[model samples]
Every structure is written in structure tokens, then in C-alpha cells.
Target chain A: MDLVNVISYSLFAIGSFFLVVAAIGIVRLPDFYTRMHAAGKSDTLGQSLILLGLIIHEGASFISIKIFFIILFIFIANPTATHAVAKAAFLSELAPWKKDGGKER
Target chain B: MFLQVALVIVFSSIIALYRAISGPTIYDRVLAVNVIGTKTVLVLVLVEFIYERPEFLDIALVYAIINFIGTIAFLKYIEKGGLT
Candidate 1:
């Protein structure tokens, strides 16, 4: 295949892997805080990578520039949104998962 | 490859939707919804290329701004205890 196809396919594969990884983390992580660690980081990166692949395929179009903008927006917004959720959880005094050792902090 | 990426995004959407619907807390649901919104932004941009419609980028931009506003408003409401 040509380089465009190769790059696009690779990005697509990587993005899919990251997305699945985030999903697994969300399901298997012990608590909300830990789950955020998984979903926030993994999902954001996954979306960006996938967008990169597709934008490259689009190749020098105005739509491609807009795609990049969408990526930028997500890069800014996803983590901020996650932080807000986590902060809200903390400020509202939502309890974390109890440790197996029964220690409270 | 383009189609594959779209499929992956859709798969992630399913996962996020699960979180949104099955959350034990309101924040978790909101987080999931936010994730879905970000994914939608990417999806919209991709759709522009897929459909050969550059105008769709305008729609994506609008969606991005609206989604950000919606998430922030939700957070503000929660912070003020108005949502609870």
C-alpha cells in the first residue's frame, strides 16, 4: 500500500486499541478516581489519534484544518471536563472506594 | 481505513454510553456524556470528509462550542446544588 494508506491504517489500529483499552480500564478499575485515570487519558488520546488518521486521509482540505481544530478543542476540553467531574466529586464529599486494609484518610 | 476509524469511534461511544447510563453517581454520568461529546466532535469532522462536505465542519464547530457550554453549565449547576 501507499504511505497514506499505511499511515492511516496504523493510526486507525492504534486508535482502536486505545479506545478498547480505555473501555477495559473503565470496567475493571477499582473506583471512580481510578476510572477517570483510565477513561480521561486513554479516550482523549484515542480520539486524537483517530482524528489524525482520518484528517491525513482527507489531505489538505479545509475540512482537514477543521478536523485539526476539533482535535485541539478536544485536547483542551476533554481533560478539563474530566477534572471538573473529579473536582465536583471531591468538593461534594463523595467517598472513594474503601481500601481493603480499612484505612480512612 | 477511514471506515475503520469511524467504527472505532463508534465502539468508544458505546463504552461511554454504558458509563453514562450505568453510573452510580451523577458526576460519572456527566463524565461519560462529556466523553461522548468529544468523540462526536471528531466524528463530525470525519463525517465531513466521508461525505465530501466541508460545510459540515461548521456544524462540528458549533457542536464543539455547545458541548463545552453544556458541560460547563452542568458543572456549575452541580456546584450550586441546583442540579441535586
Candidate 2:
């Protein structure tokens, strides 16, 4: 309806779309690395956008501050978690999916 | 509108749960959990706004922190063979 509402609505729509895409990627991707790729990238942006939309919808309040902090924490921690998983798999000698039909381990 | 979006997120989480259930390796499960945990946070935020409940925001914040810590801890134990 208003500018703030319009902006928040669009944000929600976009964020939800990315979330779905991430989910699909996780389900449909061939290997752990690729699944992590989808989850890591899309989850970060999608979740942040949703939270940001919430803040915008709610206006300036203490709740907004709390959500803001959550956004910051997610931005830092989510990627760290993703990288840690990938690195651990690499160290463990996990084989990747190959295009020659050599499926993952 | 917020509720509709939140439901959509929940549906996405359900779809992602497929990976956790049938993932070939442990790390894939971890990845699934990580993605689902973050989505849960978003749902909580939307629930708070939709229901006019302020306390849910607090829970959502704590969940975000705990989710990160859990993921890191799992990875550490797996990679190092011990938490230390």
C-alpha cells in the first residue's frame, strides 16, 4: 500500500523465492559441494532479505535492532559454517561427483 | 502477506529436509541442518510480526546464535576427531 509496505512485500517475495531455489538445489544437486554451494549462497541472502523485510515492515523499534543483529551474525556465521563443512570434507578425502557418471561416495 | 510468505518458507524447509534424510554423506546432512536452521529463524521473525508477539524475536535471536555454534561444533568434532 504505502512505500514501506511495498518495499517490504517485494523483499519478502524475493527472499522466499531464493529460499525455494536453495531448497531445490539442495535436493537436486549432484554432490555435497554443490549442495553446500546452494545452501550457503542462497540461504545467506534469502534469510538476510527476509529479516531486513521484517525490520522494514516493523519500522524503527527495539525488535528491529534485534533482527539487525541477527542479520549481522548470520552474514558472518553462515558462510563460516559452509566453508568449514567443505574443508572438512576435503580433508577427509571425500570424493566428488564426476561428470563421467562417477557418483559421490 | 507475511503469513503467506512464512508458509512458503516452511514449505521450502520441508523440501530441503529431503537432503537431510537421504544425503549420502555426513556433511550433506550438516548442510541441510544449517540451511533449515536459518530458515527457521526467518519463520520465527515472520511469526512474531504476524502475531504481534515480541518475545518470539528473542527466541529467534538466540536460535540464530545457537545454530551457528552447533554447525561449527559438529564440523570441528568431525574434522579434528575431538572437540578439544
Provide fnat values for all models in the order shown. 0.60, 0.95
Candidate 2 chain B superposition, TM-score: 0.96
Docking quality (DockQ) of candidate 1: 0.55
User: Judged by DockQ cut-offs, is candidate 1 incorrect, acceptable, medium or high?
Assistant: medium
- Give the per-residue Cα lDDT of candidate 2 at B63: 95
User: In model 2, which regions exceed 4 Å deviation?
Assistant: A102-105
Local distance difference test scores for all models? 0.80, 0.90
Candidate 2 — what's its lDDT? 0.90
Q: TM-scores of the models, in the given order? A: 0.89, 0.95
Query: Pick by TM-score: which candidate is best?
Result: 2
lDDT value, residue A52 of candidate 1 = 89
Off by over 4 Å in 1: A101-105, B82-84
Deviation from native of the Cα of residue A4 in model 1, angstroms: 1.7
- Give the number of the best model, judged by lDDT: 2
Model 2 CA lDDT for position B36: 91
Task: Point out the worst 10-residue segment of candidate 1 chain B by lDDT.
Answer: B1-10
lDDT of 2 by residue, A1-105 (tens): 789999999998999889999999999988887788798899799989988898898899898999999999999989998998999999999888888976554
